[model samples]
Target: MKDLFDEIDTHQPERQPIGEGAVLLRGYALQLGKDLLPSLHDIGAAAPFRHMVTPGGFEMSVAMTNCGQAGWITDRAGYRYDSHDPVSGKLWPPMPDAFLDLATGAAREAGYPEFSPDACLINRYEPGARLSLHQDKNERDFANPIVSVSLGLPATFQFGGLKRTDPVRKFALRHGDVVVWGGPSRLCYHGVPTLKHGSHPQLGSVRFNLTFRKAL
Candidate 1:
């Protein structure tokens, strides 16, 4: 099965539109993958990834961190964007130029131009880590698109409708793939299924996701 997946992983990237205003730019980050790694390393070092507890006091299995003017965080206060990391009580690391550029370019390619993201949430998932279906409503504006970049191990992304019970469409997201959704589909529910154990040539035993949003 690994061999089969590996074989299929070599296929060329393509643009896939999943809904009225959502599109997937497969392998869109391949050209800049090398630059992303070191940038992530530095950012992670400054703002190490850690599992956060929800408002209900449930710990999230997926570890996360952030960069840019504001960073997404959750605790007793609830899920919201903050300029400071609650852990260190200091300002979050500034978003790397490379990250900003990649996000802007990807958003522009997906029909959303002039996107200036103020918050970037970086998620790290290991085997068994999963995210339930939810909408991104914490941001101040819904007009700007959400640009998400996938890297490392491949995973299944669940893109659902406005309601929680809406039927979902799963997409195999490989390293370097970028998913962008906004406008009419901005409030759609989406999530990541449990990650299967596997190793990629570049990243071993882990998957990194970068989601850019215009958070105030």
Candidate 2:
């Protein structure tokens, strides 16, 4: 926690890919099917996705919800892992098979074949939305890798180091692109840059990101 997280409540990090692990697959998974679009609506039905507040009290630009054994939530209680949706007081939506299949496949393709993520953070970013740079240190275990799938309007992905002082590497992530980072790079600070204004025929003016992780 340095000057980095100070304005973390309001800083737009740069965009770049840190290493070879960051791959832009460009439409590699577009063949997943059109029904997948409505699948999100179903997922939201159970979780009732919302814009979560950061520990700093600022609202996140990205509307996030989850579907799995655990969901990521933040309130006055601070950012921590929870098993139930605060909105419905019920367990989060079940992770879809398509999502699980795609996640595990991407991990194996990235060389982490044994990945079994129990938490999936679904982010929806409309035009002008952005995520601040922060490490995924809240998870209970660091042994598992982070699997992120990007879809819709392209956004810059900033990957940094263990310390706030460390400079960042950025990459432009587009539809169907998946990035997996773990091992020596598992505890890195990463986030999305300011989303550009654009419209995707499938997702409209919004960008959907699936960040699959093993919370426990």
Point to the candidate with the largest lDDT: 1
Cα displacement (Å) at residue 82, model 2 = 1.1
Q: Which ranges in model 1 have alpha carbons more than 4 Å from their true place?
A: 1-13
Compose the digit string of candidate 2's lDDT tens values, residues 19-122: 54443444444535444455668997767769888777888888999989999888877988888899899898888888888788777767688999999999
Candidate 2's error at 115, in angstroms? 0.2
lDDT of 2: 0.77
Candidate 1 local distance difference test against the native: 0.90
Model 1 lDDT tens row, 59-78: 99999999999999999889
Where does candidate 2 stray beyond 4 Å?
1-26, 31-35
Clash-forming residue pairs, model 1 = none
| Model 1 lDDT at residue 130 | 96
Error of 1 at 150 (Å): 0.4
Per-candidate alpha-carbon RMSD to the true structure: 3.8, 9.7
